[model samples]
Target: MNEAIERSNPEFPPKIINGCVWKLREKSPGMVNKPSRGVFQLLKYRN
Candidate 1:
């Protein structure tokens, strides 16, 4: 995850994924995940 973020934006710091909240270094970027159903929902929402 960190690698991917870094690839896109090297300035992006490491982020910790805990449920819906995501912590990036010293900053909290708010909710990173959303409620979903099964594989169809997952495929429907691809970032």
Candidate 2:
């Protein structure tokens, strides 16, 4: 789990360095901040 996530997005692991392996990419907020209407409600809160 650790190795897979690290290679996909190298900058990811450090953001949640203290977190566990179960945390999904979508569950990790702030990683992506693209504004939209359907999914990614957090985008509206950004900027």
Candidate 3:
């Protein structure tokens, strides 16, 4: 079975989306503070 399966990318590992979401929600607190939302928004929080 291992031989039949193509090798996965070495750079990135598998992750649980729900766990990641929970962590982000807990850490950041504010909904609009996420980095991917925008650089401008992140700067907005700084001041």
Error of 1 at 38 (Å): 17
| Candidate 1 TM-score to native | 0.28
Estimate the TM-score of every prediction: 0.28, 0.31, 0.27
Q: Write the per-residue lDDT of candidate 3 for residues 1-47, one digit (tens) a residue.
A: 12112244334333443344436635666643445532213334654
Model 1 misplacement above 4 A: 16-47
Q: How do the candidates rank by TM-score, highest first?
A: 2, 1, 3
lDDT of 2 by residue, 1-47 (tens): 45666788788755574265334335766564435432333454667
Order the candidate numbers by lDDT, best to worst.
2, 3, 1
Comparing 2 and 3 by TM-score, which wins? 2
Instruction: Give the residue spans of candidate 3 off by over 4 A.
Output: 1-10, 16-19, 32-47
| Model 1 lDDT per residue over 1-47, tens place | 43555677766444532322233322432423334421112224457
- Could you say which candidate leads in lDDT? 2
- Residue-level lDDT for 19 in candidate 3: 46
TM-score: the better of candidates 1 and 3: 1
Model 2 CA deviation exceeding 4 Å by range: 14-18, 22-47
lDDT of 1: 0.38
